[model samples]
Target: MNILMALSQLEVTGAEVYATQVGNTLAQRGHKVFYVSDTLNSPHQGQYFKLRFNKRSLPRRVWHVFYLIYLIFRYKIQLVHAHSRASGWSAYVACRLTNTPMITTVHGRQPVHRSRKKFHALGYHAVAVCENIARQIVRDLGVAESQVSVLRNGVDSQVFKPLAANHGAKPVIQIIGRLTGPKGQLVYQLLEQCIDLAANQVQVISGSQIDPIFDKFKTKVKFCGYSANIRQTISQADLVIGAGRVAMEALMCQKPVFAVGEANAIGLISVDNLASAMASNFGDVADGGKTELDIDYPQLAKQLRSALKQPKVDEEVYQIITEQYSLEKMTQRLLELYQSAYVYTKKREIPIIMYHRVIHNDPSQHGVYGTYVTLERLEQHFQTIQRMGLSPITFQQLDEIGLDHRFDHGKRYIILTFDDGFKDNYDLLLPLLKKYQFKAMIYAVTGTDHNRWDVEHPSKPDQRFELMSPQQLRDIDRSGYVEIGGHTVNHPKLASLSHAEQQHEIAYNKAQLESLLERPLYSFAYPYGDHNEQTKRLAKQAGYTYTVATDSGPVALHEDLQQIRRIVMFPSTTKFGLWRKIKGNYTIKKAAKPQTKNLS
Candidate 1:
């Protein structure tokens, strides 16, 4: 699968780091990844495009949308993952225009306003870094709870794990963050009140430039600007002070962390407050209704003093980080989300109604495997479909629509399919189809005119039915109401046959049908809806654009075109049952039921 990762930033951020790590993991797993961002700070394993996503000009935003659409089509991108609001806005519009699927990761708290609520571009799904951010997204942006997932930032334990302990006279305390905005203010406040300069050595690891206010403490505090190897700097520290991913990495290294962030302040992360600290992303996010950091200078000072003195290593912290916050675990979760979002965005919910034999007599007396529906019941089914304003379409038409990407969300369509090419389909079903001006596809077995397979079977030898003859199939093909498809020369379970046998059965029957009708067939049906991967490949090799099964397939229609799912219509089916089956949730509901034989 091709995936695009979009980020709107001028400098390296936690979101950028997260996206790069996940993208590299996906690339290693054979997925093609592409990056589009204002700047690339981390080493990415895929192609990168430089775009000014952080710029808010109207023309630049429109250009972003167009370029994204081009990338989606040119690369055949299956999904897009936007990491910030500025990029997500353009990505959302591009995805909507191209009918592509996208998801957004909300890395931090967003400002609440009317425009933010109304124009929130959180795509088909939103991933929040923590529970607090998830709640804020739902409450502030009006995104549904079901669409929001709370996934914390992952830490690479291999690089950040505990090294030899630093046993020094005075403990080394490190503060790691960008010295701007709320983080800069927090740094200043900590230096002025929380840190006891006489007892512990302080190191500030940030950018190259330093604020003038920090000059007063320059003599006492070490300003180590922008170390490329953060793990080395972290290894030298006895206690790390930061928030979000920094706190997680510190815990992975088996070092104590003083968690403070833009939103709030967590004095020290311990087993007692670990859950709360994780929920708020180590104090990078506030609880509901709180906008600023809740700080107590004297209390924080006391906690810091105690932590510096003890500097105890908690094994539980390391265990939790290794188990729940590992890079591999996070990458797997992200892959699941990408596939789900892709299905949600690209799937068409048109229900395909399956029938085997339409008889005039009472079906219960002769029905086996629920394959028969009475003529009266069939008419009633057609009436229900017409009353519900659903347009009946053939598999050929469906293929054309899918190829053109012209599915309209406002219109509803249902596929009426008849298996086995029974004589009753032409004798009893054609008149009703003509009366209603509906289209149907019938799968025909070209080698025989009778149900020899079923009649010869030991299970139910008494059950036998005549098949449509070659002339009858030709007449139906010319009727413009029904299309003919292949169902093999004999109705044998394809899965039971060898690969060569399956190939001969599928390809020979398709050839016979095309020769008889002087036209190509577009669809095929597996006998008994029984097939394996080899049989599916044979069907594709036979030139059928679509092949269908009874019930075993992916829920999304486009996910597995070779094994399209169909809803079996029983003799006892009512209008209400048909109505329920035609809805989008029927496949999901039926999946929960126990598996049964696919007699159709």
Candidate 2:
């Protein structure tokens, strides 16, 4: 297929380099490639279009409508891989004219919100960076699961070789990026990794005082000039660390590179394939039943840092994560994205979905803390959300979605959150969340005796699927969207527990959840809406930044991510009932029902 790459501008950036990199890779694969964009204003551009089709005065949407038609006819393009939402929608319009396929990659999940849903409806399939993104795309835009591909961009081992450390210099880490604007702030990790974490262990190299992001970390790390000759710098480094194109480049240079990312953010790199991950000890793959390439969650960077202390384990983990995302892997994945970009499909864009339970429907349970929403209702809910414009948003998106970024628009956006990990939650929930491209955050008990109300002896396995097992929870946690929030282990009445026990219940549960998820648990929800000032205090002590309560109202008003309230619609909440809550009206608006206990 003749592929046409589209972006607002071919500027020198990670995404741009990636597009250029992939274009270079694909070009070598013997495919006819063309480029179209706003301007060829990039660090490196051999040949591409001037894209002088300026649409000023016209509304952005209207310009896209007009450009969509022009690009289709101009290039006779069979496929369009839009780098930005602006380009993506325009590609959508072109797809209409030329019957081309269009695809969009949610690069930053930034607040572009350019409305990719139009492309989804018009033969557009979204290529998410990771599983979290796969689910997020579905949740955010009601996109069909099959159409949305979680195509993680891979690193090229051949090109980005592992670093050959000679043991002369302190360990070095390279963070290549601009130190200004939106992308600039990412280098702050240098402080956490270079200065703080590497205090006495390693030297950190990152964007410097030339950009504002360098001001804090100047004393800690060597300010490496922001340039493309990263190969030279990474070649002389002990550890090539960072995510995105940087990691790939480091790996291609044969340097052991560690990718620091949450379960969802760096969705592109996969630790599953050890052979292809960072080639440990200069391309020697780790060989052990317990693979060394494995890096657990919660403190992902911390885990890597600790592993770095253990060369054997550190090297293995590096090899796997690196190899998995090697340029070869990324190439295949990109090819798939490129293929999908031009291949028209009547698919759904992903959206955010909200879920209540994953178990059987119990009559006694109302909304909120009860297993009121059964698998049937849950499935109906997914179907209903699908019918509407809503799709599933990855739970991982929650991590990036603060003041910095927001949900995608135009397509639907759904937030799928499971209140109680009822036995059915795993049974009824997991498959569905996986099915509908939904990322669901499950709030389960971190304390012992934490579980669904074992209805009829619970009929659960040795481990309650209702409340996930450490391994299961960790697996879901690792999945990026299956966020594990504190539900009070042992289901204690927070108000009743003393400060010590309350602290233990909250903090201990978080630690336990962290153990399972392999990442520090950040969000929590009180049990039975029974948290008190003490409970809230304990929650904070336990490292929880956000806490959810049974605020029986739809989330219409702006919500505080931390201390945010929830309006649950359980089995008692019929579809009509939910409609009321979603409309900013309480479903059962009965004088703001009192908490089961004074959970305020």
Cα-based TM-score, every candidate: 0.64, 0.44
Model 2 ranges with Cα > 4 A deviation: 9-11, 38-46, 50-71, 110-123, 181-183, 192-209, 213-221, 248-258, 261-323, 326-600
lDDT of 1 by residue, 110-201 (tens): 88999989988888778888889989988988977878888778777777778666898888999998887778888999999999887889
Instruction: Estimate candidate 2's alpha-carbon lDDT, on a 0 to 1 scale.
Output: 0.53
True-structure Cα RMSD, model 2: 19.6
Error of 1 at 212 (Å): 2.7
What does the lDDT read for residue 320 in candidate 2?
52
For each candidate, the alpha-carbon lDDT, in order, equals 0.83, 0.53
Writing each residue's lDDT as its tens digit, candidate 2 over 107-157 gives 544231445453353245566554544555566566767666655555555
